[model samples]
Target: MANVSYFEAWGMWFDGRSTPGNDLLGLSMIWWGRFGKILSFVAGAAVIVDLLGPSRLSRYSDRLTGFLARRTFMATAGASFVAAITFLWITDPIGMHRLLQSVLCLTFVTAAGLLVTAVSRALPATHRVIRAASRERVVG
Candidate 1:
């Protein structure tokens, strides 16, 4: 569980050098590759914000546990592990290693997303309970 900047962490983990200009395959890759870069850049920017902008790891952890709960974590973790393993000893792997790394990087995003959802589920219930406990003002 190493904490890292979104871009650096994901980029290294899945160092698939993207060749943006290679139209060898067809038109499909060009569109996909461009968007992939956009997504990667945005994710990296978000990671930087999460780290450098007055946010704490403890805060992030709470969010992770609550939102990222059992199901989402398990699902993403499973995907990540499977993707990571797919890179092993593959020949002419179609740059699949990088793709797998990208997939693994998404697992963390899934974790964070789950954490957020968990928090949303908790706040409403807690808020309702608190509201119910409040009494009418009885000014003497």
Candidate 2:
């Protein structure tokens, strides 16, 4: 059994391996975990503020909420598709390979495209929030 150590800062466990790939994977996991936590907190706070505060925190003028929701759905669907394919391949690789040759591969490509588009849409919101917060910090 491999020994695992937990890192408080990263909020993750890591095996005692010094390999480059392991280090990179650990770092990426940490980054994603932190990013997700921060984003969730920010989004939750925004909702609370919008509900309770006299003035709205930030309002999107361009139907961005719908666009983001749609993009999020696409990304989620794409991820689910890929997950199902992975499970199918694990259960029956030969059958999965044959199916992939027919249509699964194309579907995988489409899912990847959706993921890319979703990522593109997601980044701007993060940047916009960061900019707004910085301005508020400076002004207030």
Candidate 3:
């Protein structure tokens, strides 16, 4: 399983309908080097929380949130690609792709950080707009 192909690795990583060992969640055996499954679950949960935040898109600020969400999605996908490359390389599927992995992770992490900042910056503005709109509706 260590030197499995990219297609097979992906099948294990994604396909829920696959057999027991083929499941992506079953990948702990191969890449459980440090952080372990708990960390992975936390990371996945954080991404979901960010995507499903309470901000409604009807507000002007939610537009920025949408932008942030799109950018974050791309950054995360890029990171996933890099991580898969690293995993494959480390597993001897190809060789040591550590350098490529590091580079890809670094780039995507920076992009993600910037997108997070953009979302943060818009939060206050969005909140203010929503509050004002509410106040106006109540008054009228």
**Alpha carbon lDDT of each predicted model:** 0.52, 0.57, 0.58
lDDT of 3 by residue, 23-114 (tens): 24446333543456779889998887557543442354656556655676565566656655655556555554778766765666566556
lDDT of 1: 0.52
Q: Is candidate 1 or candidate 3 better by lDDT?
A: 3
Off by over 4 Å in 2: 1-94
TM-score of every candidate: 0.25, 0.31, 0.34
Residue lDDT tens for model 1, 1-140: 23334464346548875434333234434565688899999999889855653324334544545554555656555554554454343422545566665665566556555655565567556544433433221221
Q: Which stretches of candidate 1 lie over 4 Å from their true place?
A: 1-100, 136-140
Quote the positional error of residue 34 for candidate 3 in Å: 34
If both were scored by lDDT, which would come out higher, candidate 2 or candidate 3? 3
Query: In TM-score terms, which candidate is top?
Result: 3
Q: Work out how many backbone clashes candidate 3 has.
A: 1
Candidate 3 structure, TM-score to reference? 0.34
